[model samples]
Target chain A: MLQVIRNSLYFGGVAALSDVSFSVERGEIFALIGPNGAGKTSMLNCISGLYHLSAGRIVFDGKDITRLPAYKRAELGIARAFQNIELFKHMTVLENLMLGRHVRMKSGVLAGGIYWGKAQKEEVEHRYAVEEIIDFLEIEHVRNMPVGTLAYGLQKRVEVGRALALEPKLLLLDEPMAGMNSEEKEDMARFILDIHEERETTIVLIEHDMGVVMELSQHVAVLDFGMLIGFGTPEEIQANPKVIQAYLGEESLLEVQG
Target chain B: MTAVQSPFAIGCGDFRVNYTQDMAIYKNVRVRRRVIFLVILFFLFPILAPEYYVSLATMAGIASIGAIGLNILTGFTGQISLGVGAFLGVGGYASALLTTRLGIPFWFALPLSGIFTAGIGALFGIPSLRLKGLYLAMATLAAQVIIYFLFNHWDALTGGTGGLVVQRPSLAGFSLDSEMSYYYLMLVILILTALFTLNLFRSRVGRALVAVRDRDLAAEVMGIDLFKYKIIAFAVSSFFIGVSGSLMGHYTLVITPENYGTQISIEYLAMILIGGLGSVMGSIYGAAFITLLPVVLRELMTAVREVFPNLESIFIGIKEIIFGGIIIIFLIYESEGLAKMWRNLKDYIKLWPFSY
Candidate 1:
């Protein structure tokens, strides 16, 4: 459950997002679709607490999380998979996933330094959880390899697995299937579906592929410039003239009118 | 990521059976045995060696502690500091003052000095949240200059460059005044510090710090509080550095600002750089190597002076050049430091006859 009310973002007097309002029910894959610079990523960044909005409030799981720090939002089960694959490059995939378990872990420096009793147990427990994610993503083969050395598709999968490692309530995925092949994209789509169905995790996804967006997302919101131009069920959104006009050329819409 | 295996081999000998085994610090039976053997050898070294060698080892041990501390900040957390010298001074001065003024026992004074220096180090580290790379390095350089100035000019507190004389500590009526006794003490402390550091990198806190170093933005989104961990790194690093300073002060029975100059800070940086930036054992190796270098160079200079009477001054200049050149060479070719070299050597031996 997440709601954004009249969110506005400005950068040096230029609006990145303006009055973009939308809400997602507790267990749905909501898609944010737009052309280049439609502020989909910016909106996700604001929700994840990376970027601060100039004039708006974001209410997540019934709490106003507009002012909470990024880490605090993560603690509240909002995890994100970056479009550009921002996994810790030098660390092994297992270590990167363990880093996702960082907030949940409570071992202090002393206990960690000792590493004989509770800290060891804590680590093993988190390792088991991380292993589950690795299994889910089928990354067991390269689990010990540094994330930076992995192929692009594996890195994207690890990004998703990292977000899943947080056991997040609301996961934000930005261009998860971008630059992926058709087979890889299909695998990612299936993984996203399984994550939604099996875990009941709410997802806010930003994607470029229109067919995948229509097939996977229950609700779709189209943005053009900084404004939310359309919001409805996937079928309704596909039929909406505004959504087509925003995505296709303005000349196409004008030619139709003529 | 799998290593090439020999065709004649039946199976890989170092297979871990479980997650616990996989993540175990000692790794395998052989490694555990080697660690025990090394521990025994270190314990026996000072007993067999002469007093001069013992003293060198003691100094190297103390330097190892300080280098490991600096590595935690610069190498692990990716926060470069030029203020290690000042932080060490804070510890030395803090312990010196505590023991002389308050009449505290040496044991209590050591930890107190660490905490005091940690406070100062954390204060310096606040700038790191907003600054990075060379900019953060400059801020810490300011800390070095400012703290050294206080140590130099502060008349009543720091003795105004005259330096303070410290007393050797004893444990349960047994005096640590002798070089051998002090060497044993230094060795024990060094082992503890190494153990703590090694154990640290195997745990959650260590991974978080490394994550911060590699990708702070991603680390932050992963729910790691970047500033909190950075400050913690500063405090923890300074704590050990302070302890090392306290040990050094007591060993020599002197506390002087001259010992903790900016040049000394650069030397500490050199220790970690030459050892291995992020490896704990590399810090120890670098410290020992750097510590013995001047002694070896001096021995060489004296040997050459006997043959060529007028060449002593040039040798002094050459020693400096040699030291600078070694660091430059490490930066160019062996930047991973001795730790990686050690690893490569071990892997070579293990994979011999078909090492690939």
Candidate 2:
């Protein structure tokens, strides 16, 4: 469960997000839909503690996480996949996933190098968790390959798998299906559904693909010029006049239906 | 998952059963045997080699320790430091002062010096949180100048330009006085440092350092403390460098500011760059190559002079140019360094008769 109350974010005198408010319930896939520069990413950045809010606060799992650092928020079970796939390019897919288990691991330099008992055990446990993610995403083939060498669709899957590797209570996915082919998009939609159903993960996804968003999200929030224009179920959001005018426009609604 | 038969194959090898085996230092029995053989050969080298070559090997070993330390910071962590020479001086001076003034034994002084250098390195690393790349390099360069000035001018503490005389360490009345004895001491330490460094990446911290090197923003979101890891990298790197400095000071029985100047720091940087960034064994190769180049060049020049006695003066000027040219060529053609080249060679050998 997460709550953002009237969050405002500014960059160099320009308001990236203004008075935007939304709440995501546990075990729900919430979609934030908007056109370009609609503050979807700004809101996600604010929630993840990457950007400081100028006004209001964020509450996650009953704690005020407004001022927590990014890593601290990560420790509190927040994980995110970037819009552009921010993976460690030089590292293998397995290494990138293992990094997601970083906070859970407790080996210092000495124990890590020596790796005799406790460190060795921890590494094995984490590797098992990472391998499960690799299998779940069907990226076992590229598991040992550097992330940079993977195709764009595979890299996006790897990024999502990396977030899943954290076993987070809340996962933020920013454009996870962007630049993906139709088959890749279908696979990603299925993976998102599986994560929501089987893992019971609360997710807040920012997406431009209206079809995927409407199909997968239990709730939808539409943004326009840094303001939340509509918040409802998929059917209600489809009929909302303001959302149509600001985001979907008149023609795209028929496209969504067709 | 299907097993494929090789063209020139032995029996199917034992596969890794667990994470321990998977993350082992040696991947197979052959590698383990080769490593053991190499270690034995290193230990027995001084017995077969002459005194001059033994001394050169000892110098290479000492340089290897420093190069490995530099590689951990610059190569692994992606933090550029132009202050290795000053850190080495800090170690040498700290050890020398401890042994001479407080009358501490060499063993105690050695570790103490490492700690002292680590502290200084951490202090220098503080600005790295806000700085990166060339700016961070300039900041570390400032550290080199400041520490060098202190070592040069602080007469009471560092003995000024006159330098300090250090005694060779002895254990239980057994002096490490001879070059061979000292070579053994340095060799043992080098092996331990190599093993420790090689195993470092198998741990969480080591992975964190590499992650930071690859992408700091992503590493941060993954819950790695970027600043904490950076400082730790600097401190750990300086620790090994300090130990090497102490060893060198004791071996030579002298500590001078000139020995730990900016040129020496550059040379160490060259070692890691030529050896391969982020490689443990690459550091050894780099140290050996850089250490022996001048000697090899001088020998070549002498041989050339004997052939054409009038060409000596031009050879002297051309030596520096050749050194710079070789480094440039390596950077242009083999930017991954000698380690990657060596790996490519091994792969070629393994896949012989089939160019695939």
- Measured by DockQ, the strongest candidate is 1
Pairs clashing within candidate 1: none
lDDT of each residue in B1-356, candidate 1, tens digit only? 99998987645578887789989878888789899999999889988998899899999999999999999989898999999999999999999999999999999999999999999999999999999999999999999999999999997999988989899999999988898889888888888888888888878999999999998988888898999999999999999999999999998888889999999999999999999998899999999999999999888778888788878788787887899999999999989999989998998987887976
How well does model 2 score by local distance difference test?
0.91
Give all TM-scores, in the order shown.
0.96, 0.96
Cα lDDT, model 1, residue B185: 87
At residue B162, candidate 2 shows an lDDT of 90
What lDDT is reached at residue A96 by model 2? 89
Worst 10 residues of 2 chain A by lDDT: A248-257
DockQ, candidate 1, vs. native dimer: 0.84
Off by over 4 Å in 1: A254-258, B1-11
Question: How far out, in Å, is residue A106 in model 2?
Answer: 0.4
Per-residue lDDT over B283-321 for candidate 2, one digit per residue giving the tens place of the 0 to 100 score: 999999999999998888788887888677887888778
